[model samples]
Target: MITTTSLKNNRTFIILFFFLLSFIGNAQIGIGTVTPNASAVLDITSTTQGMLAPRMTTAQRTAIASPADGLIVYDTDLKALYYYSSGSTSWVVVSSGINPRLNFKRIRSTDNLATVLATELAAGGGAKYVLNSNTLYEINGTVTFNFPIDLNNAYVHGLDSNDDIILRTSGNIFEGATGGSIRSLTIRAATGSVFNLNGAATQNLIFRDCIVANSASVGTISGFGLVFLSIINFSGNTNGITYNNISQLLLSNMGWFNNNAGTYEKLTGTFTLVEKQGGFSQVDGTAIGFDVSTSGLTITGDAVLESVVFTGTNTAGYVKGYTTGSYTGYNFNNSWNVRAAGIPTETDANAVGDFSMDYTVGSGLAVSFTNNLNPSNTVKVGSGTPLTTYSNLFRFSTDAANRLRYQGKKKRIFQIGGSISFQVPGAGTYIIYIAKNGTVISQYKIYGRGQILNDIVVLPLNATTELVNNDYIEVFAQRYTGANGDIVVPNMTITIK
Candidate 1:
């Protein structure tokens, strides 16, 4: 057994056995007996039919044979996804769809309104697709939009008077389908291209924060029996991002560009008028007082100019509109930094001339009156609602330095009397913020003691103050508590005037 000839034969036999093991082992997948960079050949066999061919499990070999349909294909890097038809087995990158998201990977005809995006392996194998995670729907007979529902429901048909189907996405352009709502709901095509819809009679549409540049495909828009609010570029004018012109259209709160690029009627920088077929009127405010903003501009449309009995030149420059309302002419103001008043010329006077409203006059405690405010100097409380406990008091004041104590006041500069409440503990600094329509107007900081009633938490924001008429005022207050404060506030009485 220990002979040299037998030992040599055993070594040779072991070496040959190792080569056989190499071919069968799944642990290591190599190309061939050739070098590591040699061409790869896969030997994959399976009993299943119509099932996917197994991919090359070997990482060392780069290329893998494609599936029969080929749509179930994928690349090393996932970028574009595709679908392979079982019949023709062709690939489709774009399918009729809606609401696309980043993970969206594939496409299919069974898609409903809620079915959103489809995506998967970049190489497009496995025929992967993703549906709308949040689903969509058309409405049943319920006309009102109580809330959004699944889009796939059959009763959610989207047809309007003109027989155009409309699709509505929040903060998105309204693209009508073939037979539901009016087609004019889509983005306009080009300058002067006509999109006449004067025959429409439906709901008042509120559109905001959008763009409608003129397109050759969708021309100038003309319409009837429609209320349009805040839709930019409805006029088919390419110049301004937010401009619109409609015939027999009711408009409100909507800003328009001063540049009269394409109004069929003559317009002035001061006033731009259009024909009013259906009577229009609102809360009148003309000539009660002059607005602090711009002056001396032209007015177009049904707006009135100086009316005269005869052709004579003996009257002062004055005009009134058919509607009993006054409006500010176009103002060239780009800055939002509204000024603070009662600061002795420190406020930017220029800002007052840009806004359509007036500037503030003095400092404040604050006041509230729901009914009527007489006594020009007094804070009149009519009957709004919700009387103030100690919780609703907001105060803002300054110190010896001209520097404002409230950094928020410095940023927003002014506000309507909103609500302010506070929590005082021992002695320290407290900050109060002022706001107008939920926006930050100003802030004030105070140093004081809050040991009055520890358990009794007093809400901060108190008397809501707002200037009547063109009236406006700046509010100011000081926090008596020092930095190291533990001060107690007595029943604080705010002086309203």
Candidate 2:
């Protein structure tokens, strides 16, 4: 029923449909435009439309079988984009948003710490990032940060203690914050790098098991509760750590503030409580350790120092406390060796029980013996009477019966010098000498002749003697060759230099 012309038209229509299908398979495909971009496989140019990615919950995303490494998805639970990191074998968040799964951000040497901190701040949406108290940011290698980051309450910890985690910075690395700690890290910088801890007076900060080295200065610490424990190798700095307006500071198990260029000043401005314990050593340096002579150094409450050793050839002397402001209470233990200028006069009870060696200049006593009774007495030849009624005793104490006693721990050579005023009963030669523990020291005896009776004769006494602890010193006079009568001692001044 059909002609040969109709059969040819049907065959031509089928050939044209097959050719267009092959052309569509071999060429680029474009939507909403005639020509697609050369770089793209399927280019969809649009002004009022957007492409949609696969969206799923966290459990659904994790259930994908053998997902590709570069697979991107929008997380409904996290409300952010996440990319599958094959190297880490986890899905890392790609947006600057808070990831509850990530407790801490691990930083390596190759990672830019500044950028990571910036991301954290962006996630926090504040001027300073408030770090999680339970989080510990582990630093593994030498991380360099060019700018400073304010971490409000952060704990930056290192994996090793052998300077493996080095934080090298150009300027002040940590800005002021409160109630956090940095531990087991090596903080390094160039010369004149000021590492400041200028938090508020009510805040607290701590550093433990860390090394701050390579010419880094611990600048202007002004926190209230600051603690440093087991910090060693802190040297080569331009100046020691300065303090201002601190309340409670504890430095324990510290080693080697050695070879520093400047003095470490004491706490200044409202320092209420300070305690240094557990073996603090400062060796091989010309710098002064714990210099209290700095202007405005004040201790308003209490300071306890124990087991602090200082060994150096510093001319300024280690652990100096001179002309300081008011300190309410100080309890220095037996191991405190302070080379100070103005030390308080310890009482007799305290000095006998707790007296340590003080290497001070002109270290000795000056006492005066006055004859308050002034009684007329007779003395036979080759006999003496002990001078009594002591006054103005410095570094020397008196027994219950009034005898001068030395209260030092070590034996030292003391140059004894004084003048004794006495009245001989008659014209004769009198012998006055120093007596130790009621025994006359023969070499210290001085001979004087009184020309008339009832007249005063002043005799100069000078000698050098070695004294130990509890050695009581006294002045005695004997009638060598005179009328066997009394020689009244009116006044005697003695100085042991």
Candidate 3:
């Protein structure tokens, strides 16, 4: 019933109507299968092939204009999948395997450290960066930071020497709230600048093998254990640091060279120094190594110093302790020449034959001569007097007292030997004994006899005893069985070594 041309036109019209319906309905297009997944807009399923993303070099990928967030690209330079992050405003590398370099945020001297740290914090969910202990952050140029870099409980290590990483800043460059450490770095601060500021008291901070130079002040440190090892402070306006309300401050092998101020000031707790070498190389008469002279600056505990050497002229001496404070414990040992004002110098050992006392009685005693061993006067031997031969550790009470007091800190053994020549009024027995604090020691009592009246008798007293701090020793003689008449004592000599 229809012609051939009419049939062909109807077939074309039906095909065009179906194509327009598919376009208007937003249909999914599948290449290999008739049914496509509902989640995908374009599904290409093949058994022998995979989908290929847009591949470009790092430069080409960055050159893309106005790239949308979540834009994916295969980076040929990094050999990793890169995704654009709008929050960080950079391309983030996506990898299934762990990369060691990801743990470190490499910073060049030209790079803005604040910017780099901010980006790193954003990527790390605002947590502080943890410095790797074994890694070395080599900085070639001077890195100046305006804001404080808070090292939240991490060990920041630099190159082999402090000269490699030079930091210059006007304000505080480093701070820590919890705990941290910095080693092998040189910091140069201008006026009104502090090198480090600690915020907490329960935590500790340490600095080793570092140089702090030309600063208004170092920083106020309040912690449990603040330690400085092999640190050098050069040319600063004030002291190296101030420690307040701390538990312990230990300094070992520290050198303060040509600094305008002292090494430490405002010290408030236990301080221990070992093998410390420094002095006022500038020959500042007012400079001191440990300055506690400021009013109300008191150390609450002991200060132990060992093997400390102070070279150039320091008119004020090396250390100054608070006189009215409760800081009385000072222990020094082994080649430490610390001239502390208003504090006694403590030595480990006395010189050979240094502490010796000698006394002699010139006149004779009356009847019985009970306990008359106390010398009436001192005898001069060579160019030294009786008391002059005694060192600072030993002191003679008076001419007739004949008592030696030990004023040293350590306990020592002493040998006491003397000869007493007396004429007994009647034949009997006599005893010569050593008394410590008015108590006669039974083992040191020596007995002698006088057979006839006016008989000359000699008694030798020798004893060894241990003497502690503040102990005094004396010699006494008593007539046990002699007549009550006058007993003449010709000569008596006592020597303590």
Candidate 4:
């Protein structure tokens, strides 16, 4: 009953239905190729042509409405790949390599540093920040930043009573923290250290022209890495510095100011090289000094410093055979370099606590006596009240002008060997006592007639002599006959060289 037109239409509908069925059964669409993956709804494969992502500037990308997670885009301005993050409701960089020119969120105060830092680091990118003020900013707790960020003129300080301001508990200030400087800031630690820098590996960490004053009883700076400190003033910490597992230490114009401890700093860890240069300090005579002890350390130049007194116990395990450097305005009481043995070796012979003897053939020699029994200056000798005290012997002049006094508070060695001539009015026994600093040490009894007796001589000083600084020798004469005697000191000299 159907016509030719109806038969033609039915055939067309059957062909179209078969085509739709074939499309739904495969469920694959391919471009530039006829075959596609069985599971893929749409696939594009090409060797010459690449897939083009949605490319736009940052502002244009941010203008996207309701961007789902996993939305990919290429930032023309950053020249990096970015994807939308649903948790943050923003676009984040796909890679961790940070470009220095990337704009960073400004942290004007410490109140917002944590929030801004967390956002930047979670974006998987680097940041650059600037601190506006040089005031004390209290950190609520430990702050751990993982990106390589630049701190340009960032001055973060803490109160003298706070535990810490910018603290890192476990990791470093930032991962890949290189080529960044912490300059021109004064940081103080109240209960803890200013920069813990502990339990982390910091590379190329620089403290340029910074001041760290830590009042904590433990340490000021403690860390392990390649550290460079230029023009840094560190003070007041119990232990000035404690570094472990160091690779290289570079110091330039650094001052370890007014700090006191048994050991100023301890480098018990390992290091390959240490280079220190251009530093000066003024130390307190009593409150400030340092004793350095390292496991194995090799110094390049002399560790000569001003106002810092080094002791023999310091520098115990350092290497030897280096040229001795000079310290200005301060005396080094300890050996600069340490030898294999523990004995301290002198660098200069004329240095402190050294004894030397010199001889010269010259005129202008003189002798001085304390109590010369002459007509003009007479000293009577008897068992009386006033004249019973000991009198010092004549001093011999060694130099041409006798300007250098080796006895009486001056540092020198002494060998008391001299004779004193005496005349007795009647035959009696004259007792001459040798005394050092008003204390009787030895005596000699001389039997004399009415003539002049020149047998009164002092014995040689032995090793048992406890000669203190500025001690003078004296001799006391007494007559047993209860009569006055004339004590004449003839030509005799006590060698004090």
Candidate 5:
């Protein structure tokens, strides 16, 4: 691993090195066209004129820089220096301090070889050499490159190269064969390092879009960096509204940080909402910068979240339920009052034809379920059959005015949640007289719309309190339809908002 401490903090050293190379190149130490035929030849007391100057038939000395070098001597009368190359496979006595053919040789060969012992004698072991088009083989060792503390617009590929290669924009993301792993770093600005997944891949990597404004630097020496389908930083600005729409959407910025040692540290930036279409992301930790806030806003829809949010400050919501009962312009605890036709002396063709009273609904709303009645069938109010006559009495009971007596037999009533049995009253439409028992209560209806049902009758609980001396409990069909009378009632459902 390359230690950050190894980096020279002295800017003067770098600038000075540049000056020395420039002046030395133009000055003349000794004038002549000195050249060497062999690869590892060295000479002392050589002139700068002999080493440089154009148009001279001088073999280009492979000017290579080396970390390891061995000592060599030219003539005892001249200065001394050492030289090494793959050819000699050992150090050779070259020009002394007078002409130091660099102690190292630029091994420019395309052997595609691994672990080649090029130089035999040296201060250190064999120095790994690299050329423009040549591969820097890792061979049997791991190579680690630290990030430039002040890199510009670089991102963590996180999977691009084992050797440290901070990916720039596009194109160069993946050039040739990449083995091992390459990780990446993230930033607040849009540097555009996104990778093209459509291209050929030789390494493994994954870059996930973040939900925070700023993420930290990329971790690890990457073999390859992955940046696909990702966005840059964002500024959070949200609009709070409420309405019913097809869908609702929410979005957040990607959180980023740098690792100090192995601990991940936050990167700095402002948090803002961006236009991510219908996408949403939730990330942990803060983008190092201040002024970041938490967003708990809600978006609602059957499918995925779009741009709008329903049932939230920036969104809207709706209601649904069952519509019940009718408005007779009277607010009374009207129990399900059912009445059969009076016993008429004039019988239909055959007395066997029974005349019982049944109920049908009115436009206003409501119902009554008096099926097994001791009384017969007959229609009233506006005479014969009407359109409202065919409504289903999801719940059934008798009229409250006349009241009811519970025979203790369970009467089945259908409702939204399910079905339940209860004791009502009357042969014609009875009332279950709960007068003996103290006050008792029940949720008239709940699965859905109770507002509409409330119109016909407020819970008669208050009414029961005002019950006169003979005031008992009974069922009253407000304007519900589909009962036993002139109308043939069957399964029917009523829905409301």
Candidate 6:
């Protein structure tokens, strides 16, 4: 019914149409841009417009079959971003504020704390778990803290003011690789040492504002490192304990009491003790602040003690290299004893001392120093006698109420210095003298050419003098005759090392 020429022409036309359709279907498409990559199937470029990924619930995402490996979707139910992983056969999360290991299926049952912990740790995402409540979390069998875990509301009972918890077993309870934090918690050790890294050492453990207490000798505690930040109430352990390879002990209101002694080994870090209530003290044995059994114990920081008690045979030296400030809190009920043999040994060692002083001529006749002093150490000259007439030496007397009363039986070296500026109506002489217990130790005179002149004096006062308990250091300023001593005094400081 058809000629061969007509049939061939129709077949050629169909083949050409099919070829053109295939070319159009394979052509690259671009959005918001004129240029598109030759290899790309769809390319998008825009500053104002954003390309949104597929948003779906968890069930909808799981329902997707044979999804591409790099396919990303925002899970509306979980409010998280997830990417498909062919190897995992599921969606993988992009981020979690905490470690990915901690984002496992939470076990909310009221089962035993140990059981819940074990179940959560065994689940995928590393040895991580979250505690549901403020659990007492007693050890059922041998509990091992192998990986990083967070104890959301961990607490314990039967702890004293020292914050030392009682451990049931002395055998390494918290054993792990590193990186765990016990926050807003109280860990009561029933047996002995709470943190025992005996077999394998771990590092970077934090006890943030926590209470770690114990009884019957808190045992030897060793680890790669640990940090006790702010207000740790550590007590109990009578026989004392050893802290090995510890990084730091930030002591701000930290109390280490009732422990017979402490042997610090390989503490290559800073131990800052500033204004604490009760410090490393004990009732018996060689109470060593830190024995430094192995070298590399770099001690630093300052402390001002109202009272401190240390009794029995002393064998460890006090912390070296610390600055001392005004201290009214010294309650050393035990004999104030120091180690006989140790590095930087001393009988009663304290941090370096600090004192501040300021003086100005009284408008009401008395030429005296201001009462607003620091550390309450330096006693200012009272409103004794005003410099009404020039030649009156300003017979100044210390306001006995505010003197650095010596409590020790030995004398302390003081490096004293201050800057004095004064203006005289006529040529005059001004004398500045430092005295201890009504005895002049050092004095200097400055001659003013009827003009304002400033003088700075620094002198090492005493080498050794017995100022047995209840002596004071006094400073005096004398103005010569006919000189209108209008003094603008500032900058007076004393350093005792």
Write the residue-wise lDDT of candidate 3 on 369-465 in tens digits: 4333432111211121323233333222223244566544456777777676677767877777777765777688888789998778877878887
Candidate 6 on 1-497: residue-level lDDT in tens?
Answer: 89999999999999999977865977877787666677887889888888677899665887988999978898775567888778877678877623133233222223343555664455424444444334443322223343433344343222232332323443334433443444444544455445544312334444445555554444443443444445555555433345544444333444455453453112333333323233444333444453333344333433233333433344333332222321222212111223322222222334233344444532222343333232112223333432212111111112342133344434444444433333433444445555568664543323333333333323232323334435555555555434343443333443333
Put down candidate 4 lDDT per residue, 30-72, tens digits, no spaces.
8877777777888898999998898996667879999999899
Candidate 5 regions off by >4 Å? 1-165, 169-193, 198-205, 208-363, 366-457, 460-497
Q: Point out the higher-scoring one by lDDT: 5 or 6.
A: 6
Best by TM-score: 3
Off by over 4 Å in 6: 1-110, 119-167, 183-192, 197-204, 208-226, 238-248, 257-282, 285-296, 300-497
lDDT of 2: 0.60
Candidate 3: lDDT of 477?
62
Where in model 2 is the C-alpha error above 4 Å?
1-102, 121-134, 192-194, 283-285, 324-497
Q: How close is candidate 3 to the true structure, as a TM-score?
A: 0.56
Which digits, one per residue and each the tens of the lDDT, describe model 5 over residues 149-186? 11112122322223222323212122222222223322
TM-score of each: 0.23, 0.49, 0.56, 0.33, 0.21, 0.33
Predicted candidate 2 versus true structure: per-residue lDDT over 193-255, tens digit per residue: 545667776577777887777655666677656555455557666666777777787777666
Q: Give the TM-score of candidate 2.
A: 0.49
Candidate 2 lDDT at 349 equals 23
Clashes of each: 93, 0, 1, 2, 104, 34
Which portions of model 4 miss their true places by more than 4 Å?
A: 1-100, 103-105, 120-180, 198-202, 217-225, 235-238, 259-264, 285-288, 294-497
lDDT, model 5, position 166 = 31
TM-score, prediction 4: 0.33
